[model samples]
Target: MKVKVLVAAIGVLAVMVLVGCGGGETSTTASTAASGSTETTAAETATSAQPTKASITVGVLVPQTGFAANYGPEAQQGIDMALAEMGVDSGVEVKIITADEDVLDASNTLERLKKMVETDGAQIVIGPVFGSSQQAVAPYLTQAKIPWFSFLGASKDLAGSGGTAFVWPGADQLTAGPLGDYAAKTLGYKKIATLAPDYAYGHDSITGATDTFTAAGGKVIQQQWVPLGTTDMLQYATKIDKNADALLMWLVPSDAASFVKEYRNLGVKIPLLMFLGIFDPTFQEVGDLLVGEIGLNEYNPNLDNARNTAFVQSYKAKYNAIPNQTTAFAYTVMENIIQGVQKSGGKTSVEDLRAAMNGMALDTVIGPATYSPDGIASSNRYIVKAAQAADKTYIWDPIETYENVGAPK
Candidate 1:
């Protein structure tokens, strides 16, 4: 899709007046100045004082192929929607360039990112979905001096001091920590177990949950890691400690659906507490089996607020599908960047944009959010449970909300 340009009325009027005036001959005369003083013309001073119009190239790096491809299109949709809303009259011309960040390999993703910055001249980068991909390309991004707004939820280092000003939608600790507290303190699950894909995100998520759960006097009885793209989860399912109070786990949507089905078939009765992934659009395919499963996330389609309501309505009207976390993340990132650019008088420089973005607070579809000095975002999070209506459609019922959730320091 093309980026729609919406010119401001005042800008249009100015252009029209300039066109009507036509060209007129003018004489350039040097004016006298005092000793040790530099003479400057009124026109020269005015031109020099004007803020330079910014031309920004944004690189959209998401997995358009491989396991995570399902999310890439929606991410793009969100980007387009945000840009359209910000309009082209913000004294900046934004050009979007896209490249696939293949989920199976981080090296390829890094190469693509390097090409985007060095060859495509992308001043800002939006994503490279998976946790490992983000980690691999982080140092390169820092060296390139490109600001990245990532959807990664794995490493705290990505948002730590002295690193690239990389922003995340919501870090793993933000979602997992609250859910862990809810699981142990609220649901009274004293002994828990976890199952997750063996990667940085999985490690971060499990650690976050375990830390919070153990602190609340709960014990983690067992933990299992599944390789990415492992279709048969029966081995892991059979190993789950049935005596545990509950199982906390997450995987990519397809793998998760398959694993849940297999686990259910294996007659594992431990309740499931999920961290992200489960609320994906693919969850509808296994809704009946997933009923009553609890999860935590930063965004949900059913959130009732003016901004979310309008966003959901517009997204559905345009795409004919309900929006998911990926869409929300993409939209929020783009909106934040646009706001930063505006704050800097359309300055696209990495240093200037970073200064403008740090400590910015905005009310987004996910509710009020703020960017920390380290570039991590803090926002409201929801604890949701899957439920099926009489019509047999699944809905994420938000049972609890945690405000201003951020990554652990």
Candidate 2:
């Protein structure tokens, strides 16, 4: 779906008056010529003085099908809502062009992104949700000079001198650091096992966990990397080291649910610690089996800040569903972009928009957020445990907050 701002044509009517002195000989042809010249000049002046209507075309590249299909619609909703709030009446005409980021193939994702910019005429691009997909398309986007706002949290390389500006609402390292610290220092787990999908995100998450865990005098007893799209997690679950103090794992929501179910079925007695995934909405689906599981996130639907409260209320009112991380991050992406656009007076130039966005701070649903010069986001990260609330619905109850967690340097 596309959001477009329609521009109206400006019409200028030029009128000229000619007068003749009573005693002087009058030349009608000369007078008429002078009148015509005066009218032409007035018309030219009016045309030049008219404000130029800025057409801002945004490209949304997301997985509309395959494993990550759920994210596309949720992100779209946030993008739409932000556009609604910005209003077309701001004198900037906006258009949104969407392209599907095919989850299984990086080449296909790259081609779709190219089309968005080369064929669809998008000035700014948002998303290509997964880390692998973002990495696949980053160089091309940078070469094309289109500023990218992404949802992928796994890679910090997406920011800095030669990279696309990242807009991950929360960096993976931010949550991963706290998760590791909590597991090793707070919970006092000495031996932990790690499992995750075999990809950039998996590697990044484990690194984040291990860096802190080891520093706090904990050891990773076992590490397993599952291939993406693996449906049967039973085999991997059976291989988990039962001797470990705890297990730290992450996967896409569906895969995570499958893994947890299999782990229980196999009677793996190790405690579980999670990152990024396994939160409500997902938690609501698997909460009965996931009680006591700990995880980290940037935003929870039940977070008590005024910004978050209003966001949740508005989101439920519009979509009749609770907002998830995808929705919140996508909303923040557009909010930041709109703020930058307004700062630049509707100018969409790469340099102008980049300068406007860099070091910019805004109050988001997750609370106060600021972006670094390289476009890495800094925000609060919450440590949570899965449990049923008084309403019998599953929730991620906030246990602790790491304030103003910045992206990995």
- lDDT of all the models against the reference? 0.74, 0.73
In model 2, state the lDDT of residue 165. 60
Per-candidate clash tally: 0, 0
Compose the digit string of candidate 1's lDDT tens values, residues 1-105.
133334465577565433321122010110011101111121223235444366567778886654566776778778777766654444445667777775666
Quick one: best lDDT, which candidate?
1
Per-residue lDDT over 245-287 for candidate 2, one digit per residue giving the tens place of the 0 to 100 score: 9989988887888888888888777889987746424667678
- Screening candidate 2 with a backbone cut-off below 3 angstroms (N, C-alpha, C), the clashing residue pairs are none
After superposition, which runs of candidate 2 have C-alpha atoms over 4 Å from their true positions?
A: 1-53, 88-91, 173-175, 279-281
Would you give me the overall lDDT of model 2? 0.73
Q: Lowest summed lDDT over 10 consecutive residues: which window, candidate 1?
A: 26-35
TM-score of every model?
0.84, 0.84
